[model samples]
Target: MKVPARQALQMYCAHLREQAAGRASNGELDLVNERAGLAKAQRERIEMQNAVTRGELAPVTLIEEVLSKAGGKIAGILEGIPGAVKRRVPALSGDEIKNIGAEIARVRNIVASMSLADLRDSGAESDEDRGAGSDEVIDA
Candidate 1:
């Protein structure tokens, strides 16, 4: 039977407490406390997995916000280039300016095609790969 996350955790904690209290010899409570913590962690992990599967949880895109702010800064830099040319900066060649414009267009095309969900999925894959690496290190 499927029980709610909070209820399942609460029931497990109560059961653990009761069992521990019954078996305690005045100072053997640490082991029971550790068991309860482990159980709580497992329950919370399952709840998080369920919530993710049900689409009840979503990642907040602070990275997307930062990218937007960086885009604005890039635009300002691009705009300032024309002023630099006006001031006759010998370092700024026409071909170099054209290359910069082309690169910015390429970046825009790439960013426009990628949605937040796509980014999140890729991020999840990266996280999994990182976790797998850690597991390998531990096994070694």
Candidate 2:
């Protein structure tokens, strides 16, 4: 069984103390302390090795983590957008309001007609074009 690093270091120090007290032969005590020190080093190396083997250790990259956290935060803000716009923005002219509503409905209809698989496979240009600046209607 493998010993933990701290315990191995403690054992090594204890053996040194035994040698100092003349309770063990110098050669045997030194060998025991050396093995204990090696065990401590090996234990730490194995921990790092196991972490890499299990894919729990990853390269230090903040981009993915930052984007993941920010994406959810932005999505939450967008979810309350209708209320925010109503309260904060000046009222639009009736025709402008109607145009906005129609645009939203048109985008919704396009999204509702698309297959889940197609949407999942679609890239940014395809996604933006699907719901905006296009008159192509999906044939349901």
Candidate 3:
């Protein structure tokens, strides 16, 4: 049975949403795994310090190895989904791409100027921080 084009597109979008949900779940799992690994590494470091006090293997190399392996696993888990979604979106025209690039740069500059104090403050900076300068238009 042939589905209508709109229905097919709706099904495709639903599938993408499911995939995105899965990716989000995977991301959360990765974060939890990272946190567990971090706690484990901290514990190992403490233990290594104790071992050093008691005269053990030169220094603690195991913590570094654990951290590296955890980092690699987390990075691999996070990298797969964005590319799949990007493949589904249409490419922007040259002018549109340039506008996006400019807006991104402008936002980056604004973010760069923000200090930790500014971030923590209830009402930080003024209209100035809210893209007061630069004429980078962002079209949705």
Q: List the candidate numbers ranked by lDDT, top first.
A: 1, 2, 3
RMSD of each: 18.0, 16.1, 29.1
Which candidate number maximizes lDDT? 1
- Candidate 3: minimum summed lDDT over ten consecutive residues — where? 77-86
Error of 2 at 7 (Å): 77
C-alpha lDDT (0 to 100) for residue 108 of candidate 2:
51
Local accuracy of candidate 3 as per-residue lDDT tens digits, 13-129: 987786565433453465455667899999999998998888775634886688668856655544543444345554745565555555555555565465658768937557656
The lDDT for every candidate, in the order shown, is 0.68, 0.67, 0.64
lDDT of 1 by residue, 3-116 (tens): 999999999898778676754433655666677889999999999999989988766686568888997787677656655664676687777676656655655555557676
- The TM-score that candidate 3 achieves is 0.28
Worst 10 residues of 1 by lDDT: 127-136
Candidate with better lDDT, 1 vs 3: 1
